[model samples]
Target: MDPQVTLGERERRTWAAFVTMRRDLEGALARDLARDGLSVSDFEVLARLDQAPGGEMRARDLAAAIGWDKARLSKHVTRMVARGLVERREAAEDGRGQVVVLTTGARQVTAAAVPNHVAAVRRHFFDLIEPDELDVLDRVLTRINARAVEG
Candidate 1:
């Protein structure tokens, strides 16, 4: 690739539209969760934990599951602990490792928020996609995610 080469108009517009749509949709989802006293990040963490066996996971595994690095997961989980949304427990198996556990409050909140979140997702994203475009979008997203993982 040479610096002299530049993205032409269609490429530029496509990139811009993709960026703007992601930003706007993320903001809309954040607002939807905000009404339920959850941030997008918080919901992501709790949602992963909620799905894990026994409503808990090794802290390291939880971090990996949610694609958050340890420090960020640790800091966010600390805040969640303070709010009683989750708790950190010493792992029963290893004793040295930590486990993240979802609280009763988290279960109740997610039970309500999940449906609203789905509706919001459909409203903002899925509803707009033509049925025929779904396959294309899926492949493109898979490639993009693969590239991200590789890099």
Candidate 2:
């Protein structure tokens, strides 16, 4: 193997561990949310909307925040709307654009879900990492997120 072209054995092992840990964490969280009638995607959308200014955000912004494509977000919003979890209103500034507003029901769901979600996060994520390692992880992830946004 070319030394310059290949990952060292330790690097390869570390990457594998990271990937497996991420997948397992996501799977466990998804299962926990499922019990509350939410998938990971649903939780993500709700969480974003809940935090938006005035509990509302542009549909495009919501899509960007959740990393969903326009069409996929449209479908998800439609379903959420039907369930009384969200509502769409024509943008006052731009008639062609739409805003998604979290309904009272949605806020209620998030208020209930957040505590449980945080507990799940604590159990499945934070508890597994030491405090010092968390600082390192945060710095690494923030750098990666910045790069992704720039890209």
Candidate 3:
């Protein structure tokens, strides 16, 4: 580990602004998802599955796609299964492994909720930014993500 270094005033302000914006954005999106009877995590998982081929993926793949650990994914899958939104079945190639499949109910709910989520994102974030500004934001985030992944 390297020695701790304090951020300068400008850096501190930038960090604060980044944190605030991320929190606000996530909170607003979560609220919008809630209105459609889905949590943010649920929508994230369902949306990914909805796009996947055959509307199904392995448990590990689903976890990775959604950036969740095994335990968290297991818990959420359990809940979703109980709600009839998804089902876990033995993997066709490897019976020991499990595959997650989106139920018809999940597909229906996700299809309905996507528009609301997109609208909320636009209203709370994108609509406020100019196209040029969005380009800059995309560049900035790509740079940051690359650095984080490298580290």
Model 3 worst lDDT run, 10 consecutive residues: 1-10
Superposition error at 121 for model 3 (Å): 0.9
RMSD to the hidden true structure, all candidates:
1.5, 1.5, 2.2
lDDT of 2 at 29: 96
Better of 1 and 2 by lDDT: 1
Model 2 stretches with alpha carbons more than 4 Å out: none
- Order the candidates by lDDT, highest first — what do you get? 1, 3, 2
Find the candidate with the highest lDDT and give its number. Answer: 1
Candidate 2 lDDT trough over 10 residues, lowest sum: 33-42
Residue pairs with clashing backbones, model 1: none
**Per-residue lDDT over 1-151 for candidate 1, one digit per residue giving the tens place of the 0 to 100 score:** 6645988788999999999999999999999999988999999998898889999999999999889899999999999999999999999987988999999988998898899899999999999999999999999999999999999
For residues 1-106, write the lDDT of model 2, one tens digit per residue. 7899998999999999989998999999998888788878889989998878899999998998888899999998899899999999998897988999999988
Q: Which stretches of candidate 3 lie above 4 Å from their native place?
A: 1-4
Name the candidate, 2 or 3, with the larger TM-score value. 3
* TM-score of each model, paired residue for residue: 0.95, 0.91, 0.94
Question: How far in Å is the alpha carbon of 18 misplaced in model 3?
Answer: 0.8
Pairs in clash, predicted candidate 3: none
For model 3, how does the per-residue alpha-carbon lDDT over 45-113 read when each residue is reduced to its tens digit? 899999999899999999998889989999999999999999999999968779999999988998899
